[model samples]
Target: MRILLAEDDVSQAESIKAWLEMDGYSVDWVERGDHAILAIEQHQYDCLLLDRGLPKATGDDILTHLRKHQHNTPVIFITAQDSIQDRVGGLDLGANDYLVKPFSLDELSARVRAQLRTQHKGTSQILMFGSVSLDPQAKVVKLNSEIVNLTAKEYQILYKLMQHPERVVTREQLEESLYAWGDEIESNAVEVYIYQIRKKIGSTMIKTIRGLGYRMNLDQT
Candidate 1:
């Protein structure tokens, strides 16, 4: 999953970004609230980790603005404030979860998982699409009980497709999900990766929608 982290502290942001990437999440870091807002406007992120204090705007202001505009992306407030009033205010302002400073990376990861599970309405860690099963937490894929080894990009593409089975995903959408900002993408990169995935798995699993884009067949098993 892709996440946006808005933290002004350079060292803390780098540490958190590294930890989340190690846990198999593609993350984008922003040092200011305006940049965070711009990132949200440009990209579709699974979640947001907003520090309460920001350079351009406070985290509460960002959350309030997002809600006013009907952007319901889940947010977890990460700040030094650990008081009851602060926590209650955050929740009241539509934050999903709140984590104080000096928090464990493992705890942050667990909270992220909990929020994603709630957002997706999934009770299990395994995501099953036909004969293919993906363990998002573990970053593992299995096909018909046999483990299917996949490169990071291949797994990313497949994960994006499986996340929205039966819906045609445009090449631009796939590319955005697979790449971070300023990353160079070759022409026909999506097609190349798609071909490689089909060769590794099965061609019938992912269907090309002629001129539209690509979609996974819901009946594949």
Candidate 2:
């Protein structure tokens, strides 16, 4: 799953980012609430790990913006506030979960997975379409009981495409999801990755929409 982590403490943010990546999640880390808001505005994330006392803007304010704009991405407020009223306030601002400071990495990771399940409408962690089964948590893909080897980009492209199954995923969306904010992106990078994924998963698994982009072949799976 893709996540946006909004925490001002550099060490804490890096530590969380490292573990989330190790746990098979693609994470984008930002220290300021403004950056977090910009990231959310420009891209989509499975969840947000937000620190309430953020500089430039507060986490609650950011969550309020998300709610006001109808961005339903799940949010987990990580703050030092541990009171019931504080928790209620966070929840009222649309946070799906709340974590007190000095919490365990294990607990945070577990919460992230839980939020991901919610994002998928509580679907099983094992994503499926026909004979293909994808375990996003383990970064594993199985095609008819056979393991499919894919590069990082290939897996990301396929994962992004699979998230919406039959719906078309535009080239811009694929590109934004695949890379971070400042990476030098190639003009044909999305197409190249799509081609590579098709070669591995089978040409018929993805359909190109003349000007639109690609979608998973839902008819077969």
Candidate 3:
């Protein structure tokens, strides 16, 4: 999944990004709330980790704009504002959760997972396609009830395809999910990952639509 973090603290942002990336999530960060707004407009992020105190625009302003436009992306306020009133106010502004700074990265991860679960609704986040299953929180993929070893990028690509089994996932969309700003992506990087994924999963599961992109074959088993 993709997450956008809006924070001005360089050290904290770097640490959070590293931790989330290790947990198999693609994270893009912006130090300014204006940039955060731009990124939100351009990308379909699964969640937003926002700091209320931001340059150019406040996190509250961004959240209000998001809600006003009816964008339902989950938002978690990760700010130093620890007062009950502050937390209440943030939640009132449409944030799904609130986290105080100097908090545990582990707890932060748990909170993110909570928001994701709520977004999925009905208490289950498992994604299934035919005999293949993926646990986003656990970062595990299984084929035929057996574990499948896959690189993070491969899992992300497969997850994207599985998320929309009947729709074509374009190469650009997959690249956006797998990479962040300033990351160097090779010309044939997507193709290479797709090839590797097919070998690990099955050859007939992913169908390449010429002149377009790829789609998951729901009928494949």
Each candidate's TM vs. the true structure? Answer: 0.82, 0.77, 0.90
**TM-score of model number 3:** 0.90
Off by over 4 Å in 2: 122-130, 133-140, 145-155, 163-168, 183-196, 207-212, 217-221
Model 3 lDDT per residue over 1-221, tens place = 88999999999999999999888788999999999999999998989999999999999999998999899999999999899999999999899999998999999999998888778775447888887898876778999999999998998899888876899989998999988887799999999999999998888889998889999986784
Q: In order, how many clashes per candidate? A: 0, 0, 0
- Record all residue pairs in model 1 with backbone atoms less than 3 Å apart, i.e. clashing: none
Range of the 10 consecutive residues with the lowest summed lDDT in candidate 1: 117-126
Position 138, candidate 2: lDDT: 68
Look at candidate 2 and give me any clashing residue pairs: none
Instruction: Give the Cα lDDT of each candidate.
Output: 0.87, 0.85, 0.90
Tens digits of per-residue lDDT, candidate 2, 101-128, equal: 9999999998988887666654647778
RMSD for each of the candidates: 3.0, 3.4, 2.1
lDDT of 1 by residue, 78-190 (tens): 99999999999999999999999989999999999888877766433677888889887667899888899988888989988887787899999888887766558898999
Question: By lDDT, highest first, what's the ranking?
Answer: 3, 1, 2
Q: Cα lDDT for residue 59, model 3?
A: 95
> What value does the lDDT take at residue 93 in candidate 1?
94
